[model samples]
Target: MSKVILITGATKGFGRIWAEAFLKRGDSVIAAGRNITALEDLKNKYGDLVLPIQLDVNDRKASFEAVNKAKEHFGRIDVLINNAGYGLFGAVEETSEEEARNQMETNFFGVLWLTQAVLPIMREQKSGHIIQVSSFLGLITLPVLGLYNASKFAVEGLTETLASEVKGFGINVSLVEPNGYTTDWSGESAFQTQSLSVYDPVKAGFKAAVSAPGIFGNPEATANVILKLVDNDNPPLRLLLGSFAYPAVKKVYEERLEGFEEWKLVSEEAHGA
Candidate 1:
């Protein structure tokens, strides 16, 4: 049986690929994004199978209406892909309060609202899949990318709690953690604040590393993983898209485990005293 999938950030990257893959599987999809032209192109290419709607996921009312409209199109949606997020890369101190809030608004709150709106329908239907487009940075922290990392980390926490809570209701929550997949992430990764006083010395080197090729896995690869996830008999709670993400996460896990053991005495002493 074919499924109905609603995806955000359909203008480019994973969203677009997901849209194409779902359609190729003969499923209906509602592709939502901020770009009208891109949406139009998707519509032209996919015809009625792809319903392109312009949306900025940050708007709660718009998101609600979009979900409802998608429901009207296909009668029901089996999957919701929350992929409309932007990155802001800079030191935490270098980022303004407004910038930080913007990051959370788009990445965290936006997904929250959409999920809340859609979950009721899915619950009523007794089954659905919610896919969150998280990142490798969600697990490990990098020096200069604190602002962006913070957004994804919140996503990790949110999804972790929600997945357990919703399991009994027949809804599955899955997360995609991908390595830097040659998308517009870097260009869109805003610099909340810039100053020679802060990044002057090593700025060039940082820029070089960031702009390097093969920094991320292919977007189509991420899309294929998502497509497979949709049809999975029992999909995993989380999917790591590239080899790069696995080792990085393993390092974090081991380090945290060792650190906990090393600090066990202090922790026990504080609790006991």
Candidate 2:
């Protein structure tokens, strides 16, 4: 049976790749994005397999309308992939309040609104999967990516709580933590603040690290992982994509646990035990 998959940010990068992959697998796709021309192109290429919608996920009303449109066209939405976010690069002090709020609007609040819109349909069907395309930056942090990290961290929390709340309805929520992939994520899709000399070294070093050959994983591989995840009857709450993502997140959690154990006595005494 062909499943209905709805994806935000479906005009480019991982979202586009995921949409194509699903369509190739005989699935019906509702590709939602802000670009009408790109969406039209998708429809032209995929024909009836793809229903392209002009959707700006930051607009709450638009988000709801897109979901409703998907449900109406497909009659059911089996998967909702919240992949509509951009990276905001700059030091915490360097980014302005407006920039931070814009980042939150698209990366955090956009996910919330879209998920809220889709939940009712999924609840009625009693079977659906919500996939959040977060980043490995959500687990760890980079010096200049503070704002992006904050947005993804918010998503991490939201997806986790949502998973618990919707489990009884057969809705599976999963956060896909992808490491650096060969995408426009850092190019056309990224936002950056004016550079400050104080953070130049931090910025340069981080750039060098990620730009190293073979450090970034394949975007196709990430899409493949998501397809397998959706096919499973029991999916995990979190799925880390790429070889580097799993090890990197594991290291961060290990360090966090070690640090917590070191402060166990002080933490315990805070309760006046």
Candidate 3:
């Protein structure tokens, strides 16, 4: 059966790749993005299989309206891929108030609004899947991506809670945590805060970390994994993409566990009578 999948940020990166993959497999796609013109080729090639909508995910009203429009046109939305977010690069002290709020507005609140908008529709259907494109940074952290990490960490908490809440309603929530990808996420799509000379060393170290060999994965390779994820009857709550993600997250958790063990006496004493 052909599914109706709504994808945000469909203008480029993983969003566009996944949209094309779904369309090629005879699924209907509501490709929502700020750059509707960029999706013209997909619209032309896929014909009615794809609907390109101009959207800035920061607008809560527009987010709800997009969901309603997709539901009306497609009769139902079987899957929603919330891939509409960008990276903010700057050290904690270097980030401005405006930059911090904007990052959360789009990356965290955008996901919240869209997820809220689709809940009623999916609840009514008694079946649907919501995929959030988080990052390996969500589970850990880095020097220059402090704000970006906070946003994804918020997403991680939100989606984990959502999965538990929606399980009984037949709504599946999955967080697609990818490590660095060879996408424009860190290039054209990224926003860099005004730099301070004090943070230059921190920024340089961050740059070198990302530029390391095998740190990034091909964005195209993710389509099949996404397709299978939605098709599976028992999907994972958190699906880590790329080779770097698992090992990286594994190391972080190991350190976290060690810290917990070291503080076990204090932790137990704090809760004691």
- CA-lDDT, candidates in order: 0.84, 0.91, 0.94
Using lDDT as the measure, the top candidate is: 3
**Every model's TM-score:** 0.94, 0.97, 0.99
Clashing residue pairs for model 1: 180-216
Model 3 residue 123 CA deviation (Å) reads 0.4
Model 2 clashes, total count: 0
Residue-level lDDT tens digits of model 3 in 139-180 = 999888999999999999999999999999999999999998
Candidate 3 has an lDDT of 0.94
RMSD of 3: 0.8
lDDT string, candidate 1, 22-49, tens digits = 8887889889988858777667777889
| Model 2, runs deviating above 4 Å | none
Return the top candidate by TM-score: 3
- Identify the runs in model 1 with alpha carbons over 4 angstroms from their true place: 188-192, 201-205, 208-213
lDDT accuracy of residue 191 in candidate 1: 48
